[model samples]
Target chain A: MQPAVPLVARVVDLVKNYYLEEVVVRALRGITIDFAVGDFVALMGPSGSGKSTLLNLLGCLDRPSSGQYFLGDQDVSTMDDDELSDIRSRYIGFIFQSYNLLAQYTVVENIEVPLLYQGCRLDERTRERCLSLAEMVGLGDRLDHRPMQLSGGQQQRVAIARALVNDPHVILADEPTGNLDSRTSDEIMQLLTQLNRAGKTIIMVTHENDIAAWARRIVRMRDGHVESDVRNDRSTDRPAPAAHAAGLTASANSLWGGDPYRQPLGNDRP
Target chain B: MIPYLCLLLGFGLLWLVVPLAFSDKGRRSFVLALRSLWLHKLRSFLSVLGIIIGTGAVIILMGFGEGSMQDALEDIKRQGATNIMIRSVKASDESSTARQQRIAVYGLTWADYERMQTIPTVVRMVPMRILPLKVHHLERSVKGRVVATTADYAVVNKVQLAAGRFLSDEDDRYMANVAVLGAHVADRLFPFENALGKTVRLDKYFYLVVGVLADRMATSAVGGSSQTAEDFNDDVYIPMQTCRGRFGEKVVSRQSGSWNAEQVELSQVTLTITDMESVRPAGDVVKDLLERYHGTKADWAITIPLDRLEAAEREKERFVGLLFWIGFISLFVGGIGIMNIMLATVTERTREIGIRRALGAKRRDITMQFLIEAVVQTSLGGMVGLLVGMGVVFAGPWVSEHIFDMHRPAVLNVASIFYSVGVALLVGVAFGLYPAWRASRLDPIEALRHE
Candidate 1:
């Protein structure tokens, strides 16, 4: 039988070393990992567990000292800075802990930034797509609002819309709800859960167990190595099956072709 | 007309080239830069003020230089480039009211005039005896200079006739009491009727006005010329023989109830050369002849307008060079101001740089954004300065003339606008590069962590 989902990203024996004031510190020591298409992963670790370093390598922000990293069959570990930037723009989406939206740009302008780097003009087609993306993220009314004017959750929504603007292969979130209250964090998590269920791949880093419970798979790291990897079939914190379905279904099918991960198994949306 | 056309062409080329040179990405970056600059409107305006002052100073200084240089050249040109002038000056040791004679017998003699006429290179010579006197015509009087000259005076001095005729050689040979009134003199003495055929009195003599000279622009005193500024409009001309017979050599004036008497045979002799090339040598010969006759007293001076013109031409080059360096130093300091502000901006926007990098902006992209921002500021400043400078250049002379009662001309140099703008752009690029390069080389990981 063909594998249920093809691998989207693979890292083999990835090693990273950092020098702090003349002392060598091993941030990531020969770690191996694979992420399948449309997979939702929660990478959990305490401080100094090398989680941020691994995330940087996975997002193509940094290259490993000695290892192989493949994103959709392209060897990206040995790529130069410019080539890495190109790869990141095309295949990786980043969600920072602090919601790094350019303070000067309007919400719509922030979303249009990735397309700007791709040499796209602000023509009608791109403008319409940017509008639709903003609307899909529930920021339809705040298109011209700057980051400072919006609340924390709205700003994150703008960041998410920006991340999805280029239709990247995998979305990397670093402590996506680290700065929010529990209620706001739950709301942000539900938004992520809906995006993942709609055939998007997401890898989030967090130290909170409850935040990790929202993901279908959890990978825990300690001392620069994966300590445990588990599938969460009974994560009670998951949202209702039908919540946010109506608004997302139309954009999901039209934008991403009706869930490539579940279509091969002949499974229909619940 | 050609300068205006060239200015129009320069603007046309700039309008066409700027849009075509930028790609879509570059346009986007340019727009982003403009938005960022707009965010701090006051800071941007202040940062650009130095450039405005610098560029305006350059154009204003060059304009004044060109204007004054043209003024001096025009004065020299009217003196006739091929003409040399010899003027009689009183010897310093001889007093006008001498202890024994009460008459200062000095200056150029009639024999010197006879000697000069024999020179082969002397194409034409006009000798004149100028006496400061008052003229009266029917109850109205005006103080003026009476010029006793030969018939060649009108042609040699470029004095054209406005009415009737100038003095003829017969007028001098027969000692006719006929005179030519200068434009202003005619207007003042007659006022209600034509001065031609009318009689005007100079001291004890009455002369018939044969002609009136046309109005001409006055010539100011320039280098190497001993006379004060002359307005030819205030002079009256008469035949040399008539003046010698009627006025004699003694000129007496009463000042504060004291009698001042001076005897000068010839006040001035202007010699025109055959061509420009022979003017200097002929001047030397005239000086040598005068020296031989006068011995060591040194009572006469020679002025060659051609020599003064050449010296002025050389001085212009040095003046322009000095002006350019002053402009360059101001622009350099203005560029430093731009650099200082841009460096602060780059440091403040470090996290923004990281965000852009993560979103796939190349190093060149960051550099281009900051560089474009700096260039936009200076270009705006340059344009404002250009308009203001041109305005001041065109209106400066008129303002000074009215307010200060001084005629200071300012000629517009069209090329200065283009030069200032190009230099402003160059300054933007030069000073903005370090900050831009610093921004581009920022480590993305660390930048994201910055506050």
Candidate 2:
């Protein structure tokens, strides 16, 4: 018997809608996606394609209007606000496109926010952890600097560190570089790739092609459903694929069959 | 004692619950509250200005109100808290006003004095015969009211002999013609020499001066409608028996070309009571006894110091309560102003609220943050206002003396300061509730989407 590896997050036929008094706008018709424990998946689509809605549901920022959503089999779609807050604080980290660091707080303080919500006092240990996270994001000397004092790249770096502060299993990034220049955008993408290479599961929402190209697999949404899913093995640098993902050695490689990113290897399915 | 324990227990409960509201998330909110308040200094001060004026006005007004009430009681108190006065009022039935111009005798007699002595609550009796007489010493003649009573008069009236001795009871028994001059009377009668052994003539009789009274603040005639008026400084005190023997009861008066004569046996009788509680009842008994003897209505009136003291206290309590509500209304209005500004603040910081929510702050944390900010504003206002109110109280009497030329006494009541500050805190929390609650209920997703 093989030991089970818990999935980071899984969703089955998720649907969401917005009501306008007399009109019901279907934001998400039906969507099914799963993120493995160490998968790096980018959700890509055009505007009005419900990619943001999917990211929101995945981030635990909102409940699915209808669907079975499991955060490691906990079925978070049925959870209430407080439970969602706990899950968001404990199980997942979020990075916004706008780099929403609290302006009044210093860089280190901003990074400590999620830890605080997790009921961690800002004692000596917490301070040390915050310093290391800031250093990890290459802001070791800017710990005491406010968000307004730093440049766009520095602020996003602070957000990245904030998202990873609690050691959450999965990170949800919503257009992490939407407000940055192309050069700064490439730097943020490199940081995300480095994190994913270290075995962190990263789920990102983006409309940019090059940004999506950094991910090992891409899921594209259109009109609230997955229009296509593809695996890009040649676009960027990542640690060579894992044995379980490459399917070159084991007869048990059929585990990749149900993967939305399995299209490129369908010739080996029989 | 039981009530005190209950109060202590209630305080302990408050101490416990207030801190629990500030859990792990609460400290961050507090820091946020402080930062946000500092971000807008002018608006915070302006918002709290109303509370300052309202609270300061209430505290200062209440202090003066209480001081004046105490002032009135002390005025009555100096007359003697345990003493009751019975005075003779001229009857209205006198077309027989000395019909024939013979001296008319009507009022408290020796029999009234004798009946007062028989009452059980009467601790001591001081009888007096007052006559307006002109006294001549050396080269000056001053007209003054002279009172004739015994040694116990000094004890009953709270008077101190400045020099020499008051008239002893022995002097009353043997009809010695020794006298005590009052402060004003002494200043007039013997301005050149000490009046201690001088002989002052009243008509054809001469009395040796034995004592002079200390200069004391003049007790203005009480205006309570039920009390009679008296001025004691311009009087000379003599032995009662000597007054009857020499001046007699009939006094002839010739003022401004009017010559008429009136006769009074005992002008007034003051009785001291041993127990304060028995005054009103003892007064009732004295009234019944006097009315039975006089056979007339309103012929005599009684004045009980204890009764007036209680009435003054009751009036002061009611006045303080009225002032309290006036203060509360202004603070209440100030609280409304706080709510209005806080609501605006909530709307303005909607994006900040969203960002905090996205950072994983709970509804409880958001509520505490805004509530603490409101608390900070009002409490700062409250403390500064307390100091300002005290400053006003300190300047009160001086301002009165320089501007209105009327004396206004004010006291700094510590209780009032505490009450004002406590009310400010209470009103801050109460008024901050709805805004905080509203801020907390904003949807996280929608809030983040807020432009």
How much does each candidate deviate from the true structure in C-alpha RMSD?
A: 7.2, 7.3
Tens digits of per-residue lDDT for model 1, B99-184: 47788788899999999998899988899999999998979988989999988888777888899998899999999999899999
How far off is residue A49 in model 1, in Å?
1.0
Q: What is the lDDT of residue A76 in candidate 1?
A: 83
Q: How does model 2 fare in lDDT?
A: 0.80
Off by over 4 Å in 2: A1-5, A239-270, B1-17, B20-22, B91-106, B118-122, B137-140, B221-225, B249-263, B275-281, B284-296, B398-406
Best by DockQ: 1
In order, the interface RMSDs are 1.5, 1.6
lDDT against the true structure, per candidate, is: 0.84, 0.80
Q: Estimate, for each residue in B1-451, the C-alpha lDDT of model 2 and write its tens digit.
A: 3245345545743773477465656666667777877898888878888789877997789778777877877888888888899877666764375676566667788988998898898899999888888778866888898898989999988888789988898999999988899888898988877889988887788899999998878765543647755667788898999999998888788859977677778988999987888888888989899889887645577878777788788887787678778878989988988899999998988877877777677787678788877877787788878888999888987899799898888888776776777777777788998999999999888888776
